[model samples]
Target: MSELARRYALALYSVCPDEQTLEQTAHVLMDDTTLWQTLCSPAIQGQEKARVLARLPVLDGHGLLLNFYRLLAEKGRMTLLPEILEAFNEEVLRQKGMARCRLSCVRAPDAAELDKLRRALCRLHHKQDVIFEIRTDPSLLGGFTLEIEGVRYDKSVRGALSGLGRQLEERRMA
Candidate 1:
């Protein structure tokens, strides 16, 4: 959640040639265990870390991204990689006119059900598309809840019970 990380990520993303290049660089950084661990691990010496980062083969031919990695090491913000990547993804989604939605339910939805929900969300949000990040929680009781573009649609059985409880409480006071 570092503002600095968001700023740096935005700066890098703006200059990124395409989403593929940006994603590839992220994959390179994340795919190398030694390089990623060394840069983010505090157990390693700063200078040694720098040397290891400098030797990352994936960084070759990616000057801007390589410099970005070096700059983070210099500023001791290597741990911000995940945050920066998240921000960059959000930016990419925004640019593509897509929204990331969270769908929570008592059980996992089937593919057909998921597609149905996706289309409804797209129509509701008026966005080009909706990407669902689905999760299941038995505690939800039944039904599902959706969070899209900061607006939440709560339709779970648990939600209805909670509303009833609150209304009863207010009525008792009245």
Candidate 2:
């Protein structure tokens, strides 16, 4: 499924006229759950789905992509929208020479905090720019965990307690 999505994304990226349009189209697809469901619903026909997609003003200037989207719906591959969006985002970042980091915390960060985090991640990766995906997971218990480039850094309270427990167990055995 993901491979198919990647292929579609690459095809779109290849023909995409401008990065801004690609970004806007991707945002529309990513943010519209109802539209996604409608597109993927067996009840909706290709013409109906095409009409709905055409109504979106953001996609107005992107005729090629809009048609591509219609084609996916017609072929019943509309459910791959999410994966295709993901791949498209990755392609955009890759084109821009940036890396994305996933940061999960117990609560949302303020603008200043987020900026600081972005800077820190940029420095950590030695990259001029970094993209961040911030999410709140209350189960983290406090603090946050950062995942990037397949490496994970766990600083949550649960992680700390687990480390402490391991240290105590080692001492008891000694």
Candidate 3:
């Protein structure tokens, strides 16, 4: 994350004392499908962004939150708002003893499989709260990769091939 994103996230998180409420607001901002679309719409004038944001009832309850949005609009930094929200949510989850886990698989896993994977990951990290992001990539061939923070567990066929190539190169050098 950039310094700008971190600063914005910290400012937004500071406005809501309750962690859950902060998380909820972050989720709303991240999940709102139309937010970026509206901001990018050419028909919408640049100066009108602040006005449009102010009329949103969801953001009106908290003055600090409202001000943050207006500031973002005024500065033309609204495009970074989603990233700011995501970073804020990550920080909140970290404070709550949670880790975000991303899984890339050849196909979508079933509910039971997802639950099992979640349990396994919890055991691996020794943390019960794990946020899972699942993505499908047919090119993976088989197996999946689990990325937690910066560490990655590569169990995919592509990874295995790369590992084998490295091993063969080392053997040739020997």
Q: Model 1 — which ten-residue stretch has the worst lDDT?
A: 17-26
Tens digits of per-residue lDDT for model 3, 1-174 = 677897878777676645565556545655777875675455677678778777777766767776776777677777786678677877787777888999999988899998898888778877767888999998888999989866899999988999999999999999
Cα displacement (Å) at residue 158, model 3? 1.0
- For 1-174, candidate 1 gives per-residue lDDT tens digits of 578877977998888735576677677777778767767777776777667667877667878877777778766778888888877887788788888998999999999998888888878778788888989988889999989767999999999999999999999999
Please give the lDDT score at residue 172 for candidate 2. 100
TM-score, cand. 2: 0.64
User: Residue 19 in model 3: shift from native, Å?
Assistant: 7.6
- Please estimate how well model 1 matches the true structure, expressed as its whole-model Cα lDDT: 0.81
- Residue-level lDDT tens digits of model 2 in 1-174: 278998998888898736577667756775788877788888988889888888988888778988988899888887887788778777787777677888999998898998898888778877668778889998889999988766799989988989999999999999
Model 2 CA lDDT for position 122: 76
What is the alpha-carbon lDDT for the whole of candidate 2? Answer: 0.82
Considering every candidate listed, which one attains the maximal lDDT? 2
The Cα error of candidate 1 at residue 135, in Å, is 1.7
- lDDT, candidates in the order shown: 0.81, 0.82, 0.77
Runs with alpha carbons beyond 4 Å of true place in candidate 2 = 17-19, 22-38, 44-61, 106-120, 123-126, 136-138, 162-174
lDDT of candidate 2 at residue 48, scale 0 to 100 = 92
